[model samples]
Target: MKIVESHKTDVDNYIITHHYLRSAPAGARLRLWVKDNSDNVIGAMMWGRPTARTYDYNRILELTRLYLIDDTEHCAESKALGMARKYIRKHLPEIRGLISYSSTGEGHKGTVYLADGWFAVGVTRAAAWNKQGRKNIDKSQKIRWVRSV
Candidate 1:
């Protein structure tokens, strides 16, 4: 397994194929991909500097770019998110609040998020990123469920 700073090499593919964490900027703190021995970009996670979103205020840091190939299994994503939260606390301790967004039908994933201790903050009526139509969360998508780190 390898963890490194995110590069553009296959970023487009990662973004095009994933959600929630995909829309993050090319560069951000902790943008990582967990690859197998073959280096098949399996999992990723990241955190953007605090920014204003549909739900939380800018004072809260945003969790971004978290994705994993479906076959990699949940343990890998958990490890990545756990490491990510740890890294966030280490580097941005002052900014203690962490927020992540997900769609509504994502019930099972939501359970995982909750088990990880993320609380349901609220729902966002607007797209988390409005300018990007693809990122737009229509009626089908729900707002972010936030957590304190």
Candidate 2:
């Protein structure tokens, strides 16, 4: 599979339609598509500033979305991640690390991240937007994974 630049609209649509969350992130700094040898779009990814205030947004980015077609070849996610990392290292040199979370509530153990050389740092506490006017959000505890670029 080959990684290609993708438009936000196309990536968002693909994520919304195929991803389990069924929604796109609000601010994606980079979007990408994974195409098979035959040129069919088989996956999409989005990277953006980390949501947590502790992370240095100028140096660290979060993989906010990653969705692949169910029938793709084995290790496709790992390959896509490897390509994306190389792209970021070359094009966004200021970036020093990448992070992503796997939701325990969603039964995700972060196998793809592990396979791509990311390490689990810790688990985040379950919290939510408790403001009176805000809508309820999933406060699932997540495993934080990180990879140095």
Q: What are the models' TM-scores?
A: 0.66, 0.92
Error of 1 at 130 (Å): 6.2
lDDT of each: 0.61, 0.90
Candidate 1's TM-score reads: 0.66
lDDT of 2: 0.90
Pairs that clash in candidate 1 = 21-65
Question: For residues 1-149, could you state the per-residue lDDT of candidate 2 as single tens digits?
Answer: 99998764889898889888777888899999999999999999999999999999999999999999989999999999999999999999999999999999889999999999999999999876553553434568999999998
Query: What would the per-residue lDDT of candidate 1 be over residues 109-145, giving only the tens digit for each residue?
Result: 4655676778886775744454545543334456666
- Name the 10 consecutive residues with the lowest summed lDDT in model 2: 129-138
Q: Which candidate has the top score in TM-score?
A: 2
